[model samples]
Target: MNNIDTRNPELEGLAKCPTGIRGLDEITDGGLPAGRPTLVVGGPGCGKTMLAVEFLVRGATVYDEPGVFVAFEETAGDLAKNVASLGFDLNGLIAQKKMVIDHVHIDPAEIEETGEYDLEGLFIRLGHAIDSIGAKRVALDTIEVLFSGFMDHAVLRAELRRLFSWLKEKEVTAIITGEAGETTFSRYGLEEYVADCVIALDNRVVNQIATRRLRIVKYRGSAHGMDEYPFLIDADGFSVIPVTTLGLDHEVSSERVSSGIKDLDAMLGGGYYRGSSILVSGIAGTGKTSMAASFVNAACARNERCLYFAFEESEGQMIRNMRSIGIDLGPWIESGLLQIHASRPTVHGLEMHLAMMHKLVSEFQPDVVVVDPISNLISVGNGLQVRSMLTRLIDFLKSNQITALFNDLTQGGGAMQSTEVRVSSLMDTWLLLGYVEENCERNRVLSLLKSRGMAHSNQMRELILSDDGIHLTEVYAGTGGVLTGLNRLTGEAKTNAAEMRQTQDLDAGARAVRRRREALKATIAALRAEYESELDELDASIARERAQQIALEDDCSMDER
Candidate 1:
């Protein structure tokens, strides 16, 4: 054989068909093996049929490849009606000759044991369906139903092999669904027949919460993701979340976004970095939500879209509460710059919550997202589960270059520095909000625990909330400890009083020194006046002596002149 490049089969006549479903093609390395039979095994209600149908629908609508869907369990009408909620117009596609759905209804009670059983009839029917629409894709929903009437494993295996062979000969990409078994991938162990690619879907419930997951079991000629991915099925249809996207290869931005609190921003070295995950953790009533709201407000003020996920409060309650702190989010909401999604943590499983968040983020395309109180997510999952969910979430947000702020409620009487979810390392900036007890009073304080790639203040600032907004005040650290609230106010008051007394004493002493200087000046002026009078008398005595001697000193006066 000529030198073949087995590593890259796509370039060597092994092309892959794109699924067009969001995130599915990425994990599959470009969807299923083209013109090959791929097995999809899943339990009941685990979305095996849905995945198969979406594959055909996307192929037909997006790739312009007509497809045929052969249903073994449900009728064409039922399948169409079931998928109608997902906006897949099966009837419309059938009318337009883009798709053909042939429901092969099989009743085990009506079947008779035959000497030799085969899928020759199925081949004729499927071949006609494909030729009718020139279909390039085919989906057999629940292959187990077709073979339920046959008890001979030899006949079943032979027929399955023949079926896959026929599809390959026709050069049509196909997906075969089978009921998942307890010990095998399928009840009949169909994984042996369809060896090109295999996918397993599961619907697992833990602690009364349900989550759908998808895993690529094997791909013969391709390098695909091996990790199990969480997928969501809603009105929008299938969305496979690829865990591979959580890698550390995501791009970073040097831009920064404000936190709305000026002093807090100053302490954070101007603001939080754009595309960074920020964690605002604190105890109850310690203004965690307030800080989150302030960040949202700042984002909205910058005319950037913001999404707020509130787990504890309703939208109205959050709006009202934020308005009290001078951060009115109503305008942003009305102006379409903000969206608040409020729900309880018990509403959905951690994976479901993550899926919903992914959906909303994709739809809204917000520049900034805030999740108030991620601690509540712990109610639905354990610590490890919550951390995994958060890690994926943070990774997703960072990959999109979206600034995400998460508020965590740290339990009181525990380590105040740690978070309940235990994902602090995932955050690029961590702001801890807490309260200090001083003088029998509780005062809120905000501290910067960590800020990556910048210089940040380490001092704890008192968190002050007023009608104007949230403010951070410099806290006093004395010999006793950090003084806050009433204690700091009292200390400042005493210091001011002492300074006032000292200033008054200094003013009084300066006044006494001025009075003494004035008395000395008066004494010196009296002494100078007396000296001038004595000098005048001495000049007069000199003049009289000169006049008495004038006659005898006439010649001397002339000489002196």
Candidate 2:
């Protein structure tokens, strides 16, 4: 582990620029180079522009490093307004002479490309902007915009090399954003080879799920995170979550927390370990929320702070419905043991949601956290982002020893079967709940799919909600099978009971037969012993008679013997 000092040398004696984005600096080993050109290449809507703009905004506000942005796409005013939502005061920074934004509009129709044209004019303009603010950071959005008026590949390629060399000579850390092609990263084709560092951004949709990924293609003289990390784009800007290492260093706790349901807690190996994450996955209306609410209430009942982020249901509705199920969240909220944050998945970017979650986790420092239906969050992000966000969230909770419960909604179809199979592999513990149809009745059923580092009962149980709260019945084996719906489970339970009674009757009959056989054996043994005793007495009498006759004879026979 190479620990590079990130403190600012100019102010407090350090030489690093913290991007102000979480999880990104850790991957870069510190941050981008202090005074070198780094290329940001990605397809359209890959957040290339937003990332560059954020770098400048953070530099100006956080580090006091004055910066400049040369925009070849949006207007200066538009750029400022677009990022205003993120709490970036671009106009104020520019007014204070701490930052400068130059919108360069090139018209290909007006210019004639008759001969080789040099980019000296572009250089002069950028130099003037840099000198005006004494900027340490510069961003040239879409450097390929210069190629709009010219078709000559040789001239454009030569000028591209010159532009990179000039930025290095100027000693300013520059970010040159370019439009990436489907086959190659950038349309210019030269940005990849010329820049000191090449970063690629990609936006993809898998199974109707959209996600954004970032990969550091190359970083000269430094080893960086080579994997494609998932990132979110929201009102606060872009945030990347670096994948965590799975090592023995992960902290384990001996403490335990209740599952809210007494029986369920007993089912677990003496309740879930503190800070362990449990996954509750099921089809819709399988009592996922009810189970999660019970857990939250249980935690709060113990005076432990808990956070519930609801992505599917409204807070008011959730609270009201939970009350019907015998969970009183009102008192917990009043006592400040429980907090519920409800929002729409599409309201903001996934990164913003993660930031909010991070913010909440930091502020509340809860002992327990619940994400009501994590699958809904996956709907908003791409598969990679979904996986990435989940991995980070799980690791964060585990590290803090905060027990987390996630509710995942599985679709009820063949297509959903594949998705569930994929998701099941990521969970530490999986609780499957669903509706089963048996005897022309639909009933709720719950079962444990798997639990890591522990032994769990392999039984399909009936789930019942009553005044006593949630209840789980013993393993039910129906005529059809053991893993059936609630009615079938109940039927199976009855069938098992009947079979058990029949088994007991058969055992009693077998015991009676064994008792009869033992009595006959004792009677025969007694007869044999009596007969042998009589025979011995008779033999003695015969000897005595012979002795009397023979005592006269046996006495005579004893005399003769």
- Give the TM-score of each candidate: 0.86, 0.70
| TM-score between model 1 and native | 0.86
* Residue 425 error, candidate 2, Å: 4.0
- Cα RMSDs, all models: 4.3, 9.2
Identify the candidate with maximal lDDT. Answer: 1
Best by TM-score: 1
Candidate 2, residues 288-336, lDDT tens digits: the string is: 9999999898999898999999998888999898888788899999888
Tens digits of per-residue lDDT for model 1, 1-561: 344655455466778999888778989888888999999999999999899999999998999999999998899999999999998999999999999999998888998886876778888999999999899999999878866766776877888899998899999999999999899998889999999999999998878887788999999978899988878887778988775554587798888789999998888878999999999999899998889889999999999999999999999999999999998999999999999999999998887798789889999999999998899998887887778778888988998999999999998999988899898999999999899986679999988999999899999999999997899999877655778998888777877898999999999999999999999999999999999999999999999889878866887878898
Query: lDDT scores for all predictions?
Result: 0.89, 0.80
Give candidate 1 misplaced runs (Cα > 4 Å).
Answer: 1-13, 247-256, 273-275, 298-305, 330-338, 359-367, 395-402, 453-455, 478-481, 501-561
TM-score of 2: 0.70
